[model samples]
Target: MASRKKNPSKARRYSVKEKEEILRYVDSVNSKQGRGGQTAAVKKYGISALTISTWLRGGGASSFKIGKTSSNGAGGVIAKLAAVHAEIQAKEKELASLRSQFEKLKSSI
Candidate 1:
């Protein structure tokens, strides 16, 4: 099986200060011209709209949690982490299955 290479430009992390600055800029623009400032901000900062919305809804980067609690009170960061772990496990299982198939074909040849 060929090895998978990590993409260098996959995800980017921004510092708290940078996020605050971007939020402030977005606020200023929105206050001046009404709505759609988030789109403008995304274009200016090269960040995703969903990320900005998360920051807005989560009350800034410091309090930002990947998953927020629901009515059941069994969510938040822990839930997000668990979800990611499950995804990784599923992907690994698929990879193993593919590898087994490849090995079977190689031996038959």
Candidate 2:
């Protein structure tokens, strides 16, 4: 067979749900075959062995981390920012109290 160049453009991005479905299929195959047969499923599905392993291990169906890094949640980041802000406010209040005590000692002299 003639060697053909691999095309990166041919790769398709799968959603978390789709990955879960693929993982389910892998698990079904593994259960029927006995032992971890994800290698076979990986070859059959044209997916990487690591991906199959992740699916079999129940690490699939998780979009939370990916979604956090993606453009899906400006709101969540804003909430985090608010929490940081509240913390800074508390620290500023403590600093002000310390400064007030320093001023009181200086004025007594």
Candidate 3:
């Protein structure tokens, strides 16, 4: 076989949910101290620090808002945002159904 550019070991794929979970842990650690969250995450999660850093820069934690160190009401904001997003998705689906129904009624008329 020809030589391959990539390594034989496959790269691990982490879902958005997984990334968020890891990031949350990292956030908690960083908050307790000052920094080194990525390094700490590397030891705990076994994920590459570079990979986590990339995720952080690439908006992997976009699902949850970051920045606030203290627990406080940050969770509340994320919850509200999620609720609103779900509502918008539901509303969009309903609108599409209504549009379909309207078209059917108009054709019948």
Best by TM-score: 3
TM-score of each: 0.50, 0.38, 0.51
Q: Write down the TM-score for model 1.
A: 0.50
After superposing candidate 2, which stretches have Cα over 4 Å from the reference? 1-12, 56-109
In angstroms, the error of model 1 at 46 is 1.3
lDDT of 3 by residue, 46-96 (tens): 989899887666544554444433122557456666778999999999999
Among these predictions, the greatest lDDT belongs to 3
Candidate 1 residue pairs in clash (backbone atoms < 3 Å)? none
| lDDT over C-alpha atoms for residue 59 of model 2 | 41
Least lDDT summed over 10 consecutive residues: which range in candidate 2? 63-72
Query: What is candidate 1's lDDT per residue for 18-46, written digit by digit as tens?
Result: 87788887888888999877899999998
On residues 9-87, what C-alpha lDDT tens digit does candidate 2 reach at each position? 7656766566767766666766797756567666767878876665445443342234434323576456556767999
Cα error, residue 31 of model 1, in Å, equals 0.9
| Total backbone collisions, model 2 | 0
lDDT (Cα atoms) of all candidates against the true structure: 0.75, 0.64, 0.75
Residue 41 in model 3: lDDT? 93
Candidate 3 has which clashing residue pairs, if any? none
Residue 70's lDDT within candidate 2 is 30
